[model samples]
Target chain A: MNLNVYLHAFTGVVKREFWRFIQQRSRFLSALVRPLLWLVVFAAGFRAALGVAIIPPYATYITYETYIAPGLCCMILLFNGMQSSLSMVYDREMGSMKVLLMSPVPRSWLLISKLLAIALISLVQVYAFLAIAWLAGVEPPALGLITALPALVLVALLLGSIGLFLSARIRQLENFAGVMNFVIFPMFFLSSALYPLWKMRESSEWLYWICQYNPFTHAVELVRFALYQQLNLQALAITLGTTLVFATLAVISFNPERTVRAAPAKA
Target chain B: MTIALQIDRVSHQYGQRVALDNVSIGLVEGQFNALLGPNGAGKSTLFALLTRLYRVQQGEIRLGDDSINRNPRALLARLGVVFQQSTLDLDLTVMQNLEYHGALHGLSTREIRRRAAEELEWLGLADRTKDKVRSLNGGHRRRVEIARALLHRPDILLLDEASAGLDVASRQAINKAVRQLCQERGLTVLWATHLLEEISLDDPVVILHRGRVLAEGIGRDVCERSDETSLDALFDRLTSAKEAHA
Candidate 1:
């Protein structure tokens, strides 16, 4: 009821998440390693095959690696968001989630706090990825890096909310592997992460439309524009709208009462 | 005796199967009460409802005159719970676990430190405060959970099978510790278990069978009313009779 109480609870949840993240050294390493591999190895191989036009975010011709850097950054957020949801499932199975849900703070705020924690952690990894890319000679303007912070946070929340919505619907940890295959792969591949929508349109009209409608595409574009010291109003509006929708669904589905109904009956 | 917690006409069903059917009970303030039931007798379901892990489907639960449905936050703030499973973060130290619980209840840092010291000392875990929970034995881990549960100084302590999966000595140790809290701190305790040996004749007991309350009263009175001399006999007879009738 009191502001101090909510503040204390928020601090507690975020601190526990950070502590857990710290202890899981492999998780941190993998979070960074996944995108770095794509940026360094995959992009290098594809540089000759894929050609990028002067997109709105790109003022001139850019190499494939440079073009995919923003997409790779969004990839980190996307994966971390799903990873955070996976941890929520783990927590639910392991009973630690009960300790969280049982707190007197409102469940909606607790969930948002959780998403915020994931977003904060994802930001650290994104910046690390950007730094690594910068060292690899993919440097954006210094001010652009500063400008991208808010945009990155927004995309992280947008992706995290989608993940939270999925986590709420997912019954067991085992089913998550299927979700990764079904959801993560399609979202990543269908988006403009690897290639531009115009490239997809040249290949197949339907694929182009799918990429255009994919929320992840907008998320990537938002980050791409922000990293170039520009704002894409259309991408910003779509990303914000999708984030709100998914966050609302996540909160509703994660209601303790609804979750009980969703749980399989046990003896 | 004051009833610190009240469950009124609560019913729950999972699809077509009834988990609890029109169940109701009042827990005595400042006493060790037992909710004794078999594996599928809806004990966990009741615990779920009480903790608000599941919504109350058909009845109301009141904690010290506040309806849980109307003011769940207020009621939950006064209730401390140790679930059937261990809820401790194994990677964290004993003190860290307690500190997390204290913060969830919105306790100030100074207050958390003071209570953590007192509770851990009382639970004989003062020396192990710095040890990660994963390093502790089963008994010690349960003790840490108990310590964490009491860190907020809640009026009522609900332990749903808190002694499950521990050695006999560990179980007895936890049982004694909670009983002491009832006597010394006037903290109402609801200890749910299927193990009959954990119930003493003088303890308040509720026997649930097949989603219904078979009997409830002081352990001695419930046994006497059923014309049984021991709790084991009374439990078997009551549950078996329900099984036959069904």
Candidate 2:
């Protein structure tokens, strides 16, 4: 409730996350490598079979790499989101969560600060990936980077909130790595991250409808449109709405009043 | 003298099992009150409620004039804690850990650095500020934790089994330091431990067993009342009755 305290803690939380991100060189490398692999190696193979339509975000046919770039960018956010939650589980196990949990700052503020930190870190990886994509001959509109920053941030918040909600709700949280794999693979493979919904519709109406409904698909579409200097209003509404929903769920689940266990470690 | 902390008939349960059964305690300012109990005597549970990590399901807990459920942030603002578990981020340097904790309490950056340096110097740990917490020994880690606890200038210090895993010398040193803190700072302390050796004969002691308080008085008084010679003997007599009864 204290603004000074809230702002100070917010800065500290973000700095700590940045320190953790930079300190673990391997984690940074892996976050970039996954998206790059899809952009460079996997995109080459899929380029022939997957033909992206001249969708609203696209005025004409685009190369598979160019088309999947936004999706892959969002892929970085998704992985980073899951990674943030995994570290939270690690914090719980290590007892490092005590300082944050016992703080006088409201639990909601603490969580929002953490989510913002995670989102900011995710931006780091997304930009790194975008730079690599540009070097590989997949150039988005130069102004698109500036315009996409806020959209990317919104998507980052959305994904991180989902991750936070999962971190709090999942009971078998010790197996969070397994949980991550299960969630990341399905959410990515099922959504429009890898292929277009229009293309998926040609294969099955059910999958097309599923992709349309997936919040992640909207997140990708938001980034995809923003990268081309276009605003996808439907994507904006879906992403913003989903962000609020998960953020609410995340805060509620992590609320201390709702937690009766002596320590979350035991729970 | 103001009551620094009070638990009014607080009770907690884990499913159908009672964790704390109508436990209560009244502690005045600057008092180093020891919560003496065997394992599973609800020592940790009591600390949880005090720290608001676990909400009070029944009765009320007050810090100064603010009841826990009434204005938790106000109560939390004046509270410091050393949990049974180590809460220091091991990957972070000692100063980083302290600074982060300071920030949590709404300390300005300048204030955080100044107070952190002061507290570390007081704890004799100014030289090791940049060392990663994982690099420090258990005793030094504990010292850093204690220093972090005081960074917020809290009126109450709740150490839940703070000396649980230390060697005898380390335990004695830390215990001595905490005792000194209570005197010098006028900070009320609720020290929870199962170790009878940790409590001085003159210190206020709350002996709890099986989620219930068995004795509530000065250690010497409890020993005298039970016709026991020392705290260790008094503890044995009180807790061993189940074996005799069985």
Candidate 3:
């Protein structure tokens, strides 16, 4: 509860996260490579295959590469969030998580501090990807970068919280892959990551409405709008609201009071 | 003097398997007590409870009059823990690890540096302060963990088998340091181990077997019930009896 003590705990967790990322250079490289592949190879191949009609805040025609930048950003956050959460699970297995959990700090504050650390690292990775995108000539709105910063942080926090929540619930890594295929990919793809809602409408109005209500879609839209220097009230509301809700769920899922059913590790 | 830690009627279970069943113990100020149990005796579970890693379904844990469950942050503010696994960052220098731990305790920049220097010196690790933990031997790494745990001057110091992997020379050194801390600083120590030799007859010992406290009192009196001269024989008699009953 002491502000200074909280800051100290926060700083410790943050430093550990930063140190892990820096030491694992291959992880950073892979993160950059995935998005680059999408922009250079996948997006290029699909540009002609995927048709783009006029999307919101767009005054003119935009290429597929330009369209999926926000999606790619979301991808980076998703991957990193999952990676950190996996490490958290590993820590638990290896007994290091016990050390952190024992640190006389409130579980909620400790978790928030951890999320903030992960989000900060995710932000760095997203910006690096953005830099690479800029070089590839996928220009977002000039001022949108600054405005989108907050949105990007929010997206990272939401994803990180989900990752935390799932880690506490799922005791094994094998189960997580199921989550990735079933949950993460759908959340990313079903949202406006690769295509616009209007574009989805041409295919199915029902599907479009689902996308419209999807919290991740709002997350993407919030970032996309910010990248355009335009703030979508609905998107912001949805993103913030989803963050609050997911964060709450995440904290509840990890509350130590709820005894975990000890399961055997993967043999 | 205040009671450093008190656990009353705490029981925890993972599903139907009881990890700690109706376990209770008291650690008073400046007392160097050890928690002794066989591998599956729930020693780790008890440590988890003490450190707030595992919350008790029944009973309560207090740290110097504060309920750890209700005020974990306040409790942690004056607590230092060295788990069975090394929490040190292999990539971080010894100095960095201490500084990071110090920060969590709300120590100032000057205070962290000063304390790190003092702790390292106390543990005969002054020369390797800048070395990454990966570069150190198991003994040195254990020393670092112990030193780091003391950085905050916690009222209760919990070491979960802290000397498990050490060589004889290293174990002796670590034990000497622990003894020094207890004698000089009056730090309450909870040394959790399965090794009978680690328990001094003078220190209070709690014998846990199959998630239950088999016996707890001064090591001499607890071991006296058996016709064994050493603690290990007494431990064998106690645990084997539990297995036979099971």
Candidate 4:
């Protein structure tokens, strides 16, 4: 209950998470590589095939790589979010989750602090991927990087909390592959990550609407606008709203007293 | 002596399967109580409830003056637990694991460092403080976990079958270490074990079978009341009758 203890606990958890991220070099590498492949390989291949009209966020025409860079940055956040949840599931199974929850703090505070640490780590990967994108010539305005920081953080927190929310429901680690298939793919592909909603509409109107409905689309749009030094009020509003909603839901699901079996010992 | 922990009329079920049934026991401060049960006799369930890993289903659990229902978090601050399963992060060094636990318990870094060094030295593990848990043997990891549990200096320590997989020497060492803590520090200890030999004849014992308390008192006294010569005989008598009824 002491304020200093709460601060120390928060710092300890975050520092432990940061060290885990550092030790697992492969996880960090994949976080960057997954999105980099999209920006460097897929975008280049699609560049000739796709023509992006000057969207509101884009006053001038843009290359496919430039168009998808922000989405890909969000992709790193998305994957890291899921990865952190996977570790949560792993921790639950391995018994480390008990060590965490036993901390003399509110369960909501513990879970939110954990989510924030994950989001912070995800942001590091986001900025790292963005740097690589810039070098690869998927150029956003230099100052846009600074402006995009807040939006990028909001998007990461939103996705990370969503992942944390999903984690509270998963009983087994193997279930994560299913989450990637059902949650991650749908959120990404059905959003504006690969193509604009109008482009989806060119194929099917309902599918385009689903893309518009997907919160990832708004997150991507938010980052896309910020990266161009523009503030799309609607995107910002939707992203902020979704962040609060998902974070609340995640914290609620993680409440210890509700007592879903922390992890049943395998027979 | 003041009672450090009291459990009254507690029962729990998994769906329709009863795991604990109206079980009650009181542990005096600074006393070591062996929660003796067979594998499925609800020892883990009771430990789970005591540690607040699971909610109390049908009765009251009191730690010091705090009740589980009214002020559970306060109760938790006064209790420590070392689960049967290893909870130490295998990839983290002993110091890292202990320091994190200390922070969770709200200890300052300087205090954690001093305690960690003191504890590791006591466990004869000071040389291995920097070693990752994965690099240590099962016994060593268990030792580190015990140290971590004590780092917060809680009055009550609940150890659920804590010596389950250790070698005989390691198990006895762990047992001696805890018993010494109880005697010297007046730590209230609930040591859950299936191994009868881990308990002393004069130590308090709670024998649980078929989700109910079969016997609870001084170990040899329980044996004498049950008209048995040894704890092993008493335990077998109680549990087999359970299997026959089932």
Candidate 5:
């Protein structure tokens, strides 16, 4: 009810999340490693086979690594999003989530604060990966990194909300592996993360449409455009719209009443 | 005595199975009340409703004058809870965990530190304040949770199976610590457990079985009213009678 109450609660949740992130050294290493592998090794292997035509964001032709750098940056956000949700599931099972939900603030506000925290952490990983990419000669314009900040954040929230929605539906921690396989892989592979939609169309029309329709594709495009100092209005609109829808669904599903009903009564 | 917390005609059903059936009880202010029920007797269900983890479907729960349905946030602000399961973050230090709880309740850092120091000192955990909960024993972890719950300084405390997994000595220690809070601070306390040894003869008790109230009153009075020789006999007789009927 009080503004200070909400602010303090938000700060508490954020601080706790950061503490957890810091303690888990392997998590930080893995978050950086996954995308870096794609940027460094996978892109190098595909450089000859994949030719990226001068995309709107790229004034001249670019190497495979340069073209996939934004996509891989979004990849880090995507994985971190799911990783945060996995932690949520873990917290729920371990009973630590009760500490968060029991706060006097509105459940919606608490969930949004959690989403924002996940987004902020994901941004750090994104920049870290970008810095590594820059050293590897895949530099975007200096101002473009600044410009891409908001886009990366928007995509992070979108991905995190999607993860939240999935976590709310997932009853047990064991079922999460299936989600990573079904949701994360398909979203990452079916999007333009590794190959342009045009290339996918040349192979198969159906795959092209699926890639185009995936909200993750727009998220990738949004980051891709921002990193090149351009704006993609359509991608921006779709990403923002999808973020709201998923976040709303997540908040509703995560309501204590609904979650309680969904959970099997322990005693 | 004023009833600080009231559960009125509350009922809950899981699909076709009723978890709690038209249950109602009043917790006397500044008293240590025990809710004794065997597993699957709706003890956890009642705690869930009290904590707002589950919605009150068929009845109302009031904290003082505020109905949980009408103003849950206000009630939550004044209520402290330690669940049947451990809710403390094992990775965080004792002080950090308490500080987090205080911040959740909107306390400033200076106030949180002061209260954390006091609660830790009272719980005899001041020396372990900087240690991660993972490094503590089960009894000490339970104590840390108790300290965290009290840091917010709520009017009533609900501890559901707070001593479930502790040794007998640790169980008694926690029971004593909570009872001390009731006497010293006049804080309303609800201690839920199936272990009869954890309860005293004079304490107010509520016995629940298969989602219904089997008996409620002073522990000895409830036993006498049922014509039983002891609390253990009373519980066994009451719960077994229902089991036989079912």
Candidate 6:
């Protein structure tokens, strides 16, 4: 398709999604509030309870709030991913997804276009949350703000693809809640969102290994490292590779035939 | 006349139950064929398969000599579909909906706007072009959908209960428009409806029951076998017989 065509489709989706969030002001507020609670209330309770450990590239003693900023950022990406997927299910039921699915262009391209749209929006919200965090006095290197953009984009894309992949399988919107509990929670809690890998190792080495291997952990680290203006080759490689894999699987699972069987009304 | 659409022994099933049993039908160029069936009688399934939403398990589908399963994109480009549910974005104006659809088919903005204007005029909806879809009456909304389907000038137009939820006046308007398109533009039309009153006596009607074709022919002739003068009674007999057998 021509660039203008792609731009029209992309802009339509982005505008629709953005307007949806705006219309539901409470949801936008909740998106900001949820992470703020974790940073303020939850982090305050555990700051002194948890011992400080000197890790590589940690220049000085950073408070719990500063340490979990990247994790909270990852949380935003994760939630946005699932939220987009939930909307996909909702649209399918309402027969709106059929409009996108039935377009004459390749289904994969259409799906990717949607993922990119979600990523762009999610990125915007993530930065908004970060700015709010900055106002809350969670200090980061000034240069870190500029460096985290690409890392956030990569994480958002990876998570968005995973959401799209899950969306293709969900028949009803209610089913997404279970995915949130099982996937989103574990991906967040088991990773270095609140604590360090070393801290987890002191408590349980196996848990530390799991955290190290968690793709979300890599996503967080990719941002965490870049926020410090440090190169994180491992994190970047893992995030990029995982993104490709999830994207491929999402496209496969979202095969048009399966989508038809899953929701005949949508097709 | 060249065959504009062809279905060859297509069969589809959902888990344990068959949705469309081995069945086939063809629509020639410039033909308006009515697909008649009761709820759960496989009419929707057939429509889904035709739109490539569901793949055929045992048969092939061809659109103008090209296997739909092989060249879905090319086939889809030449096909227009108005689904049973509302596909129009409620928040978007009618003109905006048409613009997005045209873009998906690779139309430039100027061309899309030009065609959108022409289509609205043709559908007698030029005044409502800028109105949000939710603000329109049911009939006007249906007209917009039909106009959107024609945005790409598809060779074949598929309507899956397009008149559902519309009032009597709107239904008549849609029927008139569809008939006119078939007669004047030579567009192949597959109009799916449960109401037999929607089918014309001279129109080709395919009666589907429980995923199989129960009867196919001129509407009057098919109804005549049961001494039914109208299409409705003919459909009642066909479906009642199947229900009894089941």
Q: What are the DockQ scores of the candidates, in order? A: 0.64, 0.59, 0.46, 0.53, 0.67, 0.43
Clashing pairs in 1: none
Residues A105-144 of candidate 3 have per-residue lDDT tens digits of 6678889998999999999999999998999999886688
lDDT of 5 by residue, B103-126 (tens): 888887789999999999999998
- TM-score, one value per model: 0.96, 0.96, 0.91, 0.96, 0.97, 0.90
Cα lDDT of model 6 by residue, B81-135, tens digit: 9988777888778887887777677776688889989989989999988788989
Q: Kindly report which residue stretches of model 5 are placed more than 4 angstroms away from their true locations once superposed.
A: A257-267
The Cα error of candidate 6 at residue B10, in Å, is: 1.6
The most accurate candidate by DockQ is 5
lDDT of 2 by residue, A124-206 (tens): 88999999899999999899998999999999999899888888865445678676677888788778888988788889999
lDDT of 1 by residue, B2-111 (tens): 88899999999887888889999999988899999988788888888888898888999998768889998888888889888788999988887887788888987778
Candidate 3 lDDT tens digits, B21-77: 898888767878888987778877777667666666788888765886787667776
State the lDDT of candidate 6 residue by residue for A1-267, as single tens digits.
Answer: 567766666665665677666666777777788899999899899889875666644788888888888999989999999888898887777777767777777778777877887888788788888999999888678898889889998899999999988988887888987998888999999998778888899899899998988999899989998889987999999999999999999888885554443334321
Angstrom error of the Cα, residue B34, model 3: value is 2.4
- Expressed as tens digits, the lDDT of each residue in A82-199 for candidate 1 is 9988988888777888888778889898899899989999998899889989998898888999999999999999989988999888878899998889888999999999998888
Q: How far in Å is the alpha carbon of A38 misplaced in model 2?
A: 0.7
The 10-residue segment with the lowest total lDDT in model 1 chain B: B95-104
Query: What lDDT does model 2 reach?
Result: 0.86
Q: Report the candidate with higher DockQ, 1 versus 6.
A: 1
Worst 10 residues of 6 chain B by lDDT: B100-109
